[model samples]
Target: MTSRTAQNGGHYGAIVVGGGQAGLSASFHLSRAGIDHLVVEKKTAMHKWRDERWDAFCLVTPNWQCQLPGHPYDGDDPNGFMVKHEILGYLDRFKAKVKPPILEHTAVTAVERHAAGFRVETSAGSFTADAVILATSLYGTPSTPRAAERLPDDILQLHTVDYRSAEALPPGAVMVVGSGQSGAQIAEDLHLAGRKVHLATGNAPRCARFYRGREVVDWLWDIGQYNITIADDGMGKKRHDTNHYLTGRDGGRDIDLRRFAQDGMALYGRVKGVSGGRMLFEADLTSNLDAADRVYNGINALIDRHIAEKGIEAPPPSVYVPLWEPAEEPAELDLAAAGITSVIWATGFRPDWSFVGLPIFDGTGYPVQRRGVTAVPGLYVLGLPWLWTWGSGRFLGVAADAEHVVEHLTAAVAAPRQLMAQAG
Candidate 1:
């Protein structure tokens, strides 16, 4: 490795920003295609899997889905969920095997159009490339509601990215906002850790971890659920928008809103705002729970239909009854009286494309691309949710999408050389 100062103004055929799964996968494809490329990472490879995730976090997808370029899980635990360390180890092994040309601790400061390609200015140095693939995972920046700013300064407020374990938080009831996968899991973690947890529920879909003796993921895969592309129709778009609130806890068990309520976790509606130290919430808790139940039932129906149509022998469907009695929705929460001393905003994340000085983003600041290909030549994005298929952002599908982008990029790189050869 060269000193940062010495590598200033270097050039490469291609540049990949981020050293996560997406970028590493892209580098593998680029290297195999004999393309001269450099991968610039602000932190170590798979930094989020190592640092940002919580202590108990596990892959919601099963081990078999942990597919990267030239690496697939061949272990016996295909149905088992991988813990945080296991995922990190897998990424490390993949990195060692592929050996992508990565410049660690090199943060990209700005990326601007340079002639037909791009000029990437980083903390380490500036580099020009014929193509640039922004593989910085879609969820780079933690997004909190605007109301969070109004909370008292004394309250220890942290986003999911900052949360590790319940011990890290101050002693008191913890209010976890957001009912998506992260929020639900964190709420469970806090509750299991003996903290009085209050969860702000949303309309995220819920699914059983296993259905008919097979993992839910396996069932979904068999039914071609992950292959649903954006162009399929409005139904595909709706499926892309819905967040699956399944848990990989307890070696992969079903997670439902009713379970949280039965476990004595106070469920509130979607958080509306905060004023005078009181957090206002919508009175939609029951509706949200009902909606999740509907989604679960719908998934079961689909599975049943698939089994019947294919004559697949599977275990009988298990009937699930609500474990908790419905309670009146609390319109507001008095933080002080409830003894809540901290808040974990598991409100999810958005892409941080501030470094990309381009007009490729949509109104929501997400890149507007067609399967990772941007309108701007030589500029691409990978590992984005719903980039092509439902699994585009997932570990199972990131490498395929990366390969798709690199093929086009390498072709573009080769075009000029071929033209010069023909001219000569």
Candidate 2:
């Protein structure tokens, strides 16, 4: 391999930002290609998985999908989901397997074009590399609605990132906003902990954990759903769609909010805002519930069709029936009167690319990349949802995207040096 080492204290053929699974996956393939690279992480390699998630957090998908390059899920339970510590153990094992050169506790502040290739400014020091891989996962800045500020100053509010357990909150009812995967699961976690939970449902879809005698994810894998690319016709819009709410906690099961309501957990619609010290909600609870069920059944129907076409024998398909229905849609709730003392915003996050000193972005501020390769030469993005396929964001597909990006980068890095050597 040709060494095009630019004059700098920290230089490499490639510099990968973020030490999460995505970054490590890239380093794995880069090493295979014999490229001299370094993985720069803002925190320890397993920081996010260790610190960001709640105590009860587990993989919503099955464990078989945890496919990092050269290191597949070696756990005994492929069908079972790995909980918080188990997930950390898996990642730790993968890190050891790849043995990538990594610098932890280093925050990358900026990346701009440089004469050599790209100049990366970090807390530890500056680095020059022939290529840059922004391996930061899809989540960037935690986002809570502006209305959260209007709530009475006394009511404690926390985003999902800060939530550890229901017992950690002060003794009182907890209101969880957003019905996405995080919201629904956290609500269940709190409800199961004997805490009164008021969940504000969103438009996020839901799906069954097991369907037709098999896991829904396994069925989807058979149908090649995970392989679907963003470029597929009519699939581009799916990139922004909220993930289907389910659970892998306690083995695995569907998170049925209806049953929770029947058991006494209060349910509300999407939060509108706080006014006059009362939380206001849109009167769309019934519709949102129905919408989620529709998606749930729709997926089952897809699986049934796939089974029929392939002549695969499976149990009879079953549709979800609403166990409980709201008699009246409550539009407003006085926080103090309801004894609500804490609010958990599972409203999700927005990508922050302000540090990237480049114009390769869309109107939405999302990086414009074709399966990890950016428009700008030698700049790429890895570990983003829908980067190339549906699994790009998760452990299921980061490896493929990383391998593709590293292949393209290695060729680009070698070309200039090869030409320069011939000229000399």
Candidate 3:
């Protein structure tokens, strides 16, 4: 999408804040409806994917699921995962295909109601629109724990966003906190690089990369897992669930933290505090590991049930066995004693909605909307996890949600015009 100067903006049918996949998808549907709209982005369209991700980052899902609106994956390796560059290239092509009217390097500071409909104040200038779509994703703010500040000033620290490679780190052991997707993957990255790594684990779940003669994701898709919606499923709160950890790096594979422990990677429980150059941890390392594996096997059990019920001819179902177990829960580790020169915090992110001037949020600061359409007419939120379906945030489902929201938006926009014509 080409960047336009925001200063010339007078009024638009709609204004979409954000230029990521979600915003662009909204733009695609708006353009199809001949809705004169503008997408205002804080940075370039692919800034998040390009800037925040590490060098070795790749999609956890297969390339086939990277389906943008009107642009399905036509790549030769549909089942394979796209690395960082390949993912960006796909998005760049989609941007070219959509060619949505967007303004880059424009930070939207506030969005509030106005006489026209809504007034969006941006760093560049202000614009008015009849409707607004907040396409900025849920994970906008990087969240590091307050305990991080208690560490010694000399110890080098980095968030997952700033971490690049093992070689970039100082010459010493590394401590990684939070065992979610990013923590697990980056710990493996360092382990493979022959670095001494200490991992403080969380209760994030895991899933098998492949099971029953096909990828588990393929099975999930076939079993209608992705089709399950938040409103329809009992586990609607899965939106807030920690993402199941696996890897798409070097062709997909299961990230068994137990395997990492067996391979000499130091494993610890959740970090409780950092003080006096020592990191204190809970005595629940074994429990945390077992919790992750239970989810892994639980997913496998789900696939097995699907296969048996359908009588599908597939490989025999199997269960996962832990390769290693922590002998004891280490309560505290002196960073200086362990020679840990650096630390990586993969604690994930929180949503930033301070700019939104609407009372659409719930107690948790999450926008309260029904499949992207907010109670406040003319304002909506998209790209949030579990907005409608489990796939809502990913490329697999954003297109569908965008279409649904825009359809509602189109009807809303037409109702007034129709009433005016009838009155005339």
Maximum-TM-score candidate:
3
**How many backbone clashes can be found in candidate 2?**
0
RMSD of each: 2.0, 2.6, 1.2
lDDT of 1 by residue, 1-424 (tens): 2112326777788999988889989989998999988988888888888989999999888888888989998567887888888888888888888888888887899999997678999887788999999999767889999999998887899999999999999888999999999998888889889999999988787888888988878898989988887777774354237577887877888777787778788899999999989999999998888888888888888999999999999988665666775668899988999999999998888777899999998766778888899999899999877888877777888888999999999888889879989999
Off by over 4 Å in 2: 1-8
Task: Give the per-residue Cα lDDT of candidate 1 at 282.
Answer: 96
Q: Lowest-lDDT window of 10 residues in candidate 2? A: 1-10
- For candidate 3, what is the lDDT? 0.91
- TM per candidate comes to 0.95, 0.96, 0.98
Best by lDDT: 3
Error of 3 at 346 (Å): 0.3
lDDT of 3 by residue, 1-424 (tens): 4777655557999999999999999999999999999999888997899998888999999999988999998789999999998888899999999998999988899999998489999988788998999999987888899999999887899999899999999999999999999999999999999999999999999989999889989999999999888888486687788999999989999999888888889999999998798999999899999999899999999999998999999989898988997889999999999999999999999877989999998888888889999999999999988899888999999999999999999989888878989999
When sorted by TM-score, best at the front, the candidate numbers are: 3, 2, 1
User: Candidate 2, overall lDDT?
Assistant: 0.90
lDDT of 2 by residue, 1-424 (tens): 1112233467789998888899989988998999989888877886888988999999999999999899999999999999999999999898888887888777789999999699999887788989999988768889999999899989999999999999899999999999999999999999999999999999999999999899999999999998789999998877788999999988899988899999999999999999988999999999999999999999999999999999998888777889989999999999999999999999999877878998899988888889999999999999888888989989999999999999999999999999999999
